[model samples]
Target: MPISSAMAVKASSRINSMFRILWLSAIVGMLAACGSVPLPPEPPIPTAPSAPRGAPPLATPEDGAPLPPARIQGRTRWQPVRWAELPGFTDDALNEAWNAWIRGCERPVPALARLCPEVRQLSIGTPEEQRAWMMQRLQPYRVEPLAGNESLLTGYYEPQLDASRMPTAAQQVPLYRPPADLATRRPWYSRQDIDTAPQARAALRGREIAYVADPLDALALQIQGSGRLRITEADGRVSNVRLAFAGSNEQPYRSVGGWLLQQGATRDASWPGIKAWARANPQRLNELLWSNPRVTFFREEPLSEFDAAFGPRGAQGVALTPGRSVAIEKDSLPYGTPLWLSSPGPLLNLNRLVFAQDTGTAIVGPLRADYFVGWGDQAGEVAGRLKQPLALWVLWPR
Candidate 1:
């Protein structure tokens, strides 16, 4: 029998409600399993004092006095959570859980609230607890999820001491090599063996694609062999752009589907310029200029190596680390973070020191990090050899 439209809609709604409940239950369970630390007893909320018979009204902001308006401009709209919303969690338990989470957070609650007004209405037990709860709830949103083993999603669970322990030279050794099957990986371009324009264009046919720039020279490096370009406009209109590799000699560029608009010719690689150019070129632009590389890039060499190689000139003829090694950037994990890196083979085993001090033209995504291995052959070798899992820890500042 065919189901009625009304019945289908009702079933969908019920399913959505159940899904929300399940998600909420999972979050609560995870928090419970983590175990909340005990907090000092909160002082009782004060009752409003009865007004004296002749009490004057509060002064208005418009008066000569310096009092500001009671309601500030550009305030966020968030309402307090109702008691019924948190069914099973006790107020004290919730408060303790929130505080434990907040104490470890880099950004405190009030600062976070200014940025994310949605947190204002969330129930956090008492007024003091509100800030802590808000911080805990917001942590998940700030982290950009990466595609990797699900275990990576939880990150390193153990608490690290807040001190800068320069890894002793002895302790800094490669840990493991990537499996042989994964070790021989090459860049998409290298893998395809496409070095010419005709070959690149032919390879890109009917596939989505993008490009990255060399850190030092900022040269347009084509990332070929993806399926179809998905160009999303500011208005959320998604259009398919054609990917065309301009060959080794021809500058790699992006091509929109429509005729080139006047704005297309003038659009530089900047975000606004790219959008405007995309709008104008509609179809003529050769390639999207700002696309990031998909490979797991890292800023190469440990801080010790950097200092020994470049710090205050120990040797005159020794080449200083180029942007690839000295200026590579990590994700928001911050500079000076220690990462336990493993790649294929016994030779590659070592825990290396990395700082999140630099950013690269191609390193934008969360799971991604770019290692500068000094330019030319060294950089190429390191870039080519970087296809393995890396465990990272932000050495907390003392």
Candidate 2:
């Protein structure tokens, strides 16, 4: 199903590549200069790794009492739990989660910022060491859905698509940059109107960075809000470019799957299911698309070696570590909070430590969350099939 009608928040560049490059160059130059004359070795001071391109420095925790009891609304009741209550805590690859936790510090939760120095030290440690650190520094609190014990967990991913720099007969669907009046306009022309209206077409003139063959593929990027565009140039050289979120047409989001279900067109609403219906009824594709008035816009970011590793930056403003990062309603669970999320077998046996690093228009409630499996088709498959019951235990500061 689609996400909520809640505004799909957009983000801009947080990382400055030129700055990182210049800093690294200066460091290299200094090291080269020092090589001529050997000096007494200095004790190693653990240097904090350069953070993701644009993320802000971790804020120093306020000098005060503990965070006012994290009482969040939307059906929440925190039940105190011990580290022993966390399922698969010992078995989890806390090392993988350590990297994620580190990225999270770039946008650390106010309460957790003070502990980042200790969290930083765990990066090179073994999983057992990481687990011990977590146990000693954090307290687990099981968040119950005051309504019941059960809650829903779904998934989302970064989708990759083949595209072209210029429009052709085969690649006519255009992916646009944000129009100038996007903010001034209440609701810009929708997906349908953008194609049909002359004024709308004029508004977005000369802004297309690439064109694709499938509208659904384009729609996938819009829904995900960010993606990679593998551009096949006229010379046959292919280059990958990232489409970071620029803005969106100020219209409410409506899930086409929900429209299909409501219209009695399909029961299976997964991405594959939706694609199947699109293929079967090609003529109604526009009808399905127009159901959602919202149109997401993007700006091309030069894909770098750094980008090749992690998924897009989430609402928390940090590059997400795939498989170890998850999005929950930020209002319910503060950003950068560590969590133990588990699901039953035969569906998703997700018993692991995940950082709450992102949020979604639809992700609300104390127990609800969306697992970020990773990027590409395999990740998409997992995300599409993941609508299962879940349990959560937030590891808070003691």
Best by lDDT: 2
RMSD of every prediction:
23.3, 12.4
lDDT of each: 0.28, 0.75
Q: How many residue pairs clash in each candidate?
A: 43, 3
Error of 1 at 383 (Å): 2.0
Clashing pairs in 2: 14-54, 15-53, 15-54
Alpha-carbon runs more than 4 Å astray in model 1: 1-308, 311-331, 336-347
* Candidate 2 global TM-score: 0.81
Instruction: Please give, for residues 21-112, the per-residue lDDT of candidate 2 as tens digits.
Output: 33334443343233122323322423334656577542211212244354444577666654556777657778777777767766675688
- Name the weakest run of 10 consecutive residues (lDDT summed) in model 2: 5-14
